[model samples]
Target: MRKRGVKSVLDVATGTGFHSVRLLEAGFDAVSADGSADMLAMAFENGMKNGDHILRVVQADWRWLNRDVHGEYDAIVCLGNSFTHLFSERDRRKALAEFYAMLKHDGILILDQRNYDAILDRGYSSKHTYYYCGEDVAVEPEYMDEGLCRMRYRFPDKSVYHLNMFPLRKDYTRRLMSDVGFQRIETYGDFQHTYREEQPDFFVHVAEKEYRMEDQEEGSYGGAVSTARSYYNSPDADAFYSSVWGGEDIHVGVYAHPAEPIADASRRTVERMASGLGLTEGSRVLDLGSGFGGSARYLAETFGCFVQALNLSEVENERHRQLNAKRGLTGRIEVVDGSFESVPFPDSSVDVVWSQDAFLHSGNRLRVLEEIRRVLRPGGRLVFTDPMAADGTDLSALQPILDRIHLDDMGSPGFYTRELIRLGFVPTEHEDSPGGFEDLRAQLVTHYGRVLEETERQEAEGLGAKVSSDYLTQMKKGLTHWVDGGEGRRLTWGIFRFTLSEG
Candidate 1:
């Protein structure tokens, strides 16, 4: 990507030369390379049709890519599920190492493949989101096993073509990428930053050759051994949020009015709370539990502030990077993959500490607050919204909500005020929005029903449905409990504002 400082590119598997030509048009110095001379000839012809006389076109196999393709490049593009063509592990490793050898020290490699795990584990059909986007072109796997996946392609005129490919598992490909000396490799599902790993038709891996400096590992918390670690680290966390929230912004949306868009309301809530913090250009902000970094983006774009987002989920953090790049706000927002308990920042560093409904995950709420206080500069503001229990509620009545979030207890406004006072924070204001809960609850039920209906329709039309049964079952239960005629007591939502008093 341009954001990653890529100025020169090599289209490694330049089949038909689509990517190479596009890169050339985008002002990047691009060279096209392919294993087959026939493919290179076709690619050159295609480039010529687009008024491009490709400067370099080389015929080279991937295993010895560097030998044939001279000179290093800032980036290498190996797309269109071409990597699976290498059937053996030695060939795969050699091809990857050659790719590494061809890249600049700080170069990057972008590669894509079929979601073969879906094909090998659970029978999956292509939705044509990535590879076969043209109408009248059908692509499907006719035969699949642990190693080989034979695909059948049907053209418009009923012309058929078949190709045999190794079914590379997602994890296996990632490990290969890393083992081949790529310092960082970020994977995406069907060009989306957030998705269930099992549901996507294709996976894109962007491997970086730059060596990233390691962060300090000493005195960390809530990792591996922590209960909160297990909750956030599980694959279900990514699946649940990505499927239900249905967007890059993976937090609770506050719908002030039914007619208003949920996303708009969510942004409004962020802006409202952010305004109270007095953020301005160049202000340093810390976002706690920054899920998919929705609020961090909002802060950076709206106020021109630098936001450091701390989160526990690596999946969400990866999504955050993609979203930030897409918005061209990557420079303003930095995502840290860590727990909030230790706050991986120096004291008195941030001007504002912002969070949204993420504090209850802490088994040690007091320690979290203490870390927040330690990180804030004197007089820095703390603004956050949290879901809490209603006053005079029966403890037994809150079990379902607790079970839903895997929390032992929900924090109340009173509880937060007491804790803030103990930490020497001045509790400035609190806004109770009970209706927000009702609105979100209704929206969840409606969204679930819509998803189910669409899935059923797709199934009837002989399309593969990617919906998870467990997610639907849980939603139905929650909807039954929280609706107007539900048995469980309603939960409360509140926005709290605090400022650290200079000691």
Candidate 2:
């Protein structure tokens, strides 16, 4: 408070008035508030006894903090794990907005919450520290679930109280604070700057309200590189995919020949890839970067295999869930929201790891390969296709294509072979599907261009267009580059089959 020049401070959740009384004794102008009138009254009494002054106490809801609290302050302290009281994302965002509105230009907001992710992911055993603060009082979880952690508190008199709190993940809270316009957020675990994630019983996030430019690196193709946040997670991407290619699988297809239909080619690719691995009933499959789970559901339906499809996009995850339910394949295919870089399962848990045109999106190919290797059971197969650069190709020639997908560059078959062998995997099959890129690019150009024209005509009649013309423009450039197949810039589409060593 002294360093930040904080004079007047607002304790947003001044439970029992302990912090307010301490602030008053420390000679700082303290204003305390709580959502519960009873708690505020108790805090007021506690303040009178401790400091012989009636603490400025108010009963106010955090969502409408500005409406009840009159003026902005130099600092706002929302401590004591009070933030988890908000169960809904909407409420959390609204409360954070209100908090931001009630702060000085350079004021700081300190909020603390339990590391619910640690409790949920690993069983919780309290360090038995200063929480509750009184030896006579006892606190423990009575009921716990992913969304809610209902804690039971026992008073010295044997009376009981319960607090229903939403289990907020640390990273999620930081992301929410960022989304709510916090310029800078510094997090400390158990009041220390450095600690293991699981070791922390509580996390304190001090967010500053200041204007800071977004950090991004310039790319070769006049775009931001991997350092930039993904637009793939945005609603615009979802809206484009939902409208333009609604209900259609959005991925590259395998051309059995030069003139196969894109949809048929997609199914044929999955079938051919599955056939190489002898995918059959009861096999457990893992699909990384599973876009809307098209191939997962197809494999599950055809081979009766159980597939866990992991993807990073929430929009696609929800869509996949709904689609799976509608198609009666929910039992066979489980859609998980995650990244392939950190496969959220035990090692040696899957029989096959499948992907299609998705590996290019991952910048760290070695980490991706390591994760793929870890999740595969002994003798498990990895069958997937990715866009690769031809050997001895100049990567500078494909900056346009790389920028369109937010990638550094494409990987080659030799690169995959070397990485797989180093990771104790044998490359069993290396097939460069002949003319796959040329045929797929041509069909996409024809089909997407026609859709763009039809949608433009419909928009002229006051109907809605599903895709933006900007997408079409980018698609045209990329497709033209592939069709042009310039000497060093041509994309080589190849399928890789690898088996983990039984030893």
Candidate 1: where are CA atoms >4 Å away? Answer: 1-219, 223-236, 429-464, 479-490
lDDT by residue (tens digit), candidate 2, 402-448: 76666677887667778888898876543533311122334333433
TM-score of every model versus the real structure = 0.53, 0.52
If candidate 1 were superposed on the true structure by all CA atoms, what would the RMSD be?
11.4
Off by over 4 Å in 2: 1-229, 242-246, 256-260, 429-464, 485-489
Tell me how far the alpha carbon of residue 55 in candidate 2 is from the true structure, in angstroms, after superposition: 22
lDDT of 1: 0.73
> Could you report the Cα RMSD, in angstroms, for every candidate shown?
11.4, 16.2
Write model 1 residue lDDT over 104-174, tens digit each, in one string.
99899999998776676558677765667488777788888887889888998889999999988776787
Task: Look at candidate 2 and give me any clashing residue pairs.
Answer: none
- Relative to the true structure, how large is the alpha-carbon lDDT of every model? 0.73, 0.72
After TM-score superposition, what is the CA distance of residue 193 in candidate 2 from its true location, in Å? 34
Using TM-score, give the best candidate's number: 1
